[model samples]
Target: MSEHVLPQTELEAWGTDVQVVVCETCDWRFVLPAETSLPRCPHCFGTELELLSGEVSELPYVAPPEQAVPFAVSEAQLTGGIETFAKGIPLPPKDLNPAALRARLQAIYLPRWWVDAEVAALWQAEVGFDYEVVSHQERYSDTVGGWQARKVHEGRVRWEPRAGRLRRTYENVMAPALEAEKALRAQFGDYDVTRARPYHVDMVRRAPVRLPDRVPAVAWADAEMALRRRAGDECRQAAKGDHIREYRWQPAYPKRNWTLLLLPAYTTYYLDDEQRPQPVLIHGQTGRVIGMRKASLKRAQRIALILGLMALIIFVLSSISLLAVAVAPPLLVLGGIGLLVGMVLGLSALAPLIVVWRFNRPRRRPQER
Candidate 1:
């Protein structure tokens, strides 16, 4: 990641006095002005919100973002995603369709921390240099009684011990700003940070921005690893070596800076059969949807019931035809056909019922790391 420094005035704009509110139902955090009117929880739309007593600056594990990727997905694009998701469901709920889902869409910004640092380190490694050796091969053919000579080139690596003491600056090493960073990434994939613009309050208007849950202390380990990888690349380039192996380094970061980066996403939920909210997430830049596909129990049951009635009617007609076989000998063939048809219809009726059962069964999704 490359560094883009914000001007002093822009940095100071994020330092305004703000109040933090926590939702009692969903535990979602919201940051607003101290005197601003309270709003319902954006995640669950619950009215129960509590104001944190202390100042926003004293809030633990929360920091303002320095950059953000503004939402690029329009409402029309999100409707397309929802429509695609609504398809292929065996018995979908009425509210789970595209229009209803789109109505509940909420813009959200996820967090990633970018760290900048100045480091001084002494590093040592075995650097490998590539070389080619040419050798001549002689072959004798029995038919010709002649010798043939061929040249072969083989590639080889030469390893040499290299050591260096260096002072360097590394910037924009990204680390997860959220505790559930892995799950969020698995849910929404990666955001294009190259398109990230300087953080402005206008970009987040009417949107819920998630506070950073991973503090700098916890995130520093990841940042350090990124920095070391960059240092290794620099060392290889400096030595003019093809590869570096068994690299070791002792580094001290004399100065370090951490800034938050906000990634755009859209969140919404649909009510399931039991009227429980099931959350859905969509990428703001790319129209990707991630969530559970719920089956409607009522619809499944209704279809099963209709099929059951048809099976019953077929069974009754077959029974009546079988009785008529005794009255007329020619009717025996008709009776046999009716019996066969009834059995097929009866078996087909079980399909809808089985589908309902399978769709309603509890399924366990893979746990995200």
Candidate 2:
């Protein structure tokens, strides 16, 4: 009966599944499905989160979700995140300010693939267990009879080849169910899905439900790999008292099904210098934002020049202190001044290096007219 209920439309733009969610302030529209209960947004999270027992709900799809990792980043975390993204730039577009970016940040419901699999796996690996002993020898000497002199310490690890049958049902190991998996991963890193919750749409509002560019079938290998990798790593952990050198897991995954899971992201865009669009992706799980930023080479140069001048001033001051030390013994003062000079030059060197690092980090993609 559940198999008959699973929605398997030929992978296309989720037109009917997505609704255009609009912003009241700017009237910007993001196509999102109408959800009843969902994870709280990192930027706009408030009450209705918890009391005594943690709430568990189901996503309105075929599969059941076992976990939902709520967004862990606080507002301060977001500020630091945006700052890191803006650190280095060559003449950043005038509009690239945190205030502007924060004002435009939109909460998005990125799709996650929920996988239900009855995995029967046979795995082989080298297991290692460790032991250590402090060994001391009783050596009697003529002068000091029966005296404890030196203690020897050595470590030992017991390793052996092991094979086992691992049969387990992974309730909902999230596979990348979205078609836009690459773009999303490029924008935001992997989420901690152990904290995933059953999909409820009510707590969150603005959902930039960009339909998955990848179909479920296209992502099956990825799905299997995710589960297999997890199973192997965890099973190896169960081997207990041994370090796993190498492992191979051949799992027979039968009755694999899907669920529509949602994740959190703060998406915003800032126009670059060339009037091109630059998208910002914030991790709904961690509040880590990844996006391209333009740095001001001129600003870097100006800052460097000022620092160089400061270095020169410190050098002169150190020399002056040394010369004047005849009256006051400026060894400490002059050394302090020299240290200050070195710090200035070091800072000057770092400014341009930071600028170069940022400029090369993300390549600017020109928008086609």
TM-score of each: 0.77, 0.55
Best candidate, lDDT:
1
lDDT of each: 0.75, 0.60
Off by over 4 Å in 2: 1-30, 33-91, 133-156, 178-189, 192-197, 200-205, 234-239, 297-369
| Candidate 2 local distance difference test against the native | 0.60
**Whole-model lDDT for model 1 versus the true structure?**
0.75
Model 1, residue 120: displacement in angstroms?
1.3
Per-residue lDDT over 268-353 for candidate 2, one digit per residue giving the tens place of the 0 to 100 score: 66666555556677887788777666654555666677777777777777777777777788576766769676676857756674
lDDT of 1 by residue, 311-354 (tens): 77777877787788778777777777777777777677677667
Which ten residues in a row are the worst by lDDT in model 1?
A: 2-11
